[model samples]
Target: MDAERGGGEAPAAPRDGEGRFRRRAFLVGGGLGVLGLGGAALVAGPGGVRSAYTRVVCGSTPEPPPGGTAGRRQGTLEGRRVIVAMPRAARDTVPVVVMLPEPPGDARAPYDLYAVDRYLAASPGGFAIASVDGWPSADIVGALLPHLEAGGLDVRRIGLLGWAAGGAEALRLAAQLGSGVVRAVAATSPDVTAARAPLRELVDIPVWLGCGERDDRAPQTETMLKGLKALGATTEGGISSGCQDTAYRRRVLPEQLAFFARHL
Candidate 1:
């Protein structure tokens, strides 16, 4: 079933040094090493198109939202219960944003790191954002997306947004989905070191990364920049002076949305 929600006021264009970042551009092109995992094979195709064997897939069955609300739904992905948030919008077909959860292990981790309500408040009907409960693995993410696609969200204009550990997932999904499936990617306080192989396959997409100046993860942004550039992605980002981790996301989400507005 399609989910619907009210839209929020889009923020005014950010000003220089006022929650907006300067653009730093770079480019790189290279081939990625092939590796097999989870019974998946690797087959190189023409025009950089890799076969499904190179893709990691998870099994899932779609179920209706609980309590009659389209925003919250539960489904079984490879036997594990996965929760997804679908924004309620007036339009029948809305743009989609797949949000990956924070990396497992944090004591204070919320049920959904993407914060459905926060997004609803920011750009309610603008996009149908799905935040799923699962690790940032290729199989799991691959499984959840089809269900949303089936629910009427537009896959052609898809976007991926994540923070911290989830940021790694966003990058991997962008790479795995290849050049056509994903239009843009945004990461906040991401752990760039996670999942490097798949990340090397990314090509011809726009990526926005935000980190905190005081946060220790700031340096990793450089590492990510180099990696995305080498993979032939157009990249831009900035470091918020006093933000860190969760706080960094809070300040960056607006910028992230703005970036998506431009590219998606």
Candidate 2:
């Protein structure tokens, strides 16, 4: 099956090395703090650690509510459960952001974990959000794009967003689909090591890679950023002061959305 045609079997779930890293980072940093080892002092003592940590862990701003104007649709595609969120006052044909959830998370993860619907409502431009169950294969997204277009989305302008393992999948799919098909890609706490595509393939595509400063994957994310730059790929995002947790993702999501809005 050709990935470009979106007619291939889904790949097995990629191994999750980041899960171990998330656990370790939590235990070592948040755990020590919880154990009365000056966690409060570190957070309250303030040398900007508190501010940065709070921003990363507890987002500096409040997430918006999904206004009545927004619409949500759910169904199955290629045997995978799918969920799509359409922004407020969306046009008959809107661009879309394909969300690839972390391994073990289903189509609902984007909303349940990130409140993506609310973010979409708050975005300056209108776009739809499409998420699928399990690890996303190029075939799954490849099928998804046209499906969305059939449902009134602008398939020509597309973006991919994912977290952790899903992040890697997003990168792989973007490369496989080629720059002509994908406009931009954004990832949080991605396991780039798991992505099988060559960075050179991403030369013309705009990419955004972000992770928590305290996340164990930070170094790898930085390395990926440098590599993308070396390839002259337009890239954004770097280490922020938080660990590999939900808070960090929420804090970074707006920027990711903005990046997509600019390019897509």
Candidate 3:
């Protein structure tokens, strides 16, 4: 995977990725409050769903993620960055979908504005996030183990999210981790071509696919849902109402959050 934002009209790629730090500073230093602590804690609840997930998927944090000087990039050892607007009294450690362009202004500005907490509430698996910017898969997944051990996250439960090409990565992670991924919510996925076998090597992980009905990108996203299903990957689809830029006018986050609630 090139593991970097590929297309878009974003003017600032934020080589520093410190733009969020500036915004983070303006937040007055709030703690990772327990809004979705309820969700993360539900990992071991009744029903075979929770127990089965932990026994197979959850693991120890692999290594220490990178950390460095202020006013510079604090490399996301475990994930990427994207700007998220939380409610006034928002809590930390919520279950995040971990989309690309994580919490800072990145190349994908149009896509970055999707995961605002009010717009997309957390699911049962805690609302904490772990994003990736076209970085190495091993680096992203590998660093997460240490982040958990250091008390950065409960870690046992989390979900993944992405847009456009990022959606391809989201599904690949689910397939790579198998039962480890609680659920995947992706829109305008690019990996699902009608003739290719991109996700055929995966297992039965429930995937919620979305697309803008009028967007030309639907071909790949649609093909993915169909192909993954044919491959017995337990995949599904969700179509946003408006076409192209206005696709979000259909309120994708809410439905995705709901889908995660049921599966994660």
Q: What is the TM-score of each candidate against the true structure?
A: 0.59, 0.73, 0.53
Residue-wise lDDT of candidate 2 within 183-213, one digit each (tens)? Answer: 9988888876624445888888899999887
Of 2 and 3, the candidate ahead on lDDT is 2
Using TM-score as the measure, what is the rank order of every candidate, best first?
2, 1, 3
Give the lowest summed-lDDT range of ten residues in model 2.
41-50
True-structure lDDT of candidate 1: 0.58
Ranked by TM-score, the better of candidates 2 and 3 is 2
**Cand. 3 TM to true fold:** 0.53
Worst 10 residues of 1 by lDDT: 22-31
Query: Largest TM-score belongs to which candidate?
Result: 2
Can you give the lDDT of residue 28 in candidate 3?
A: 21
For each candidate, the alpha-carbon lDDT, in order, equals: 0.58, 0.76, 0.47
Native-to-model Cα distance after best TM-score fit, residue 243 in candidate 1, in Å: 4.2
Worst window of 10 by summed lDDT in candidate 3: 64-73
Model 1 stretches with alpha carbons more than 4 Å out:
1-89, 105-114, 194-200, 226-232
Clashes (backbone N, CA, C under 3 Å), per candidate, total: 5, 1, 25
Per-residue lDDT tens digits for candidate 3, residues 1-264, read: 233465555465665657775454333222111322233334333333333333223321222112321111124443453233222223454344455432232523433344234343332333444433443344546665344325344344556665655556666666676665444544444444545434654545667787766667676667767777777876656554445432352256556656665665
Alpha-carbon deviation at 192 in model 1, angstroms? 2.4
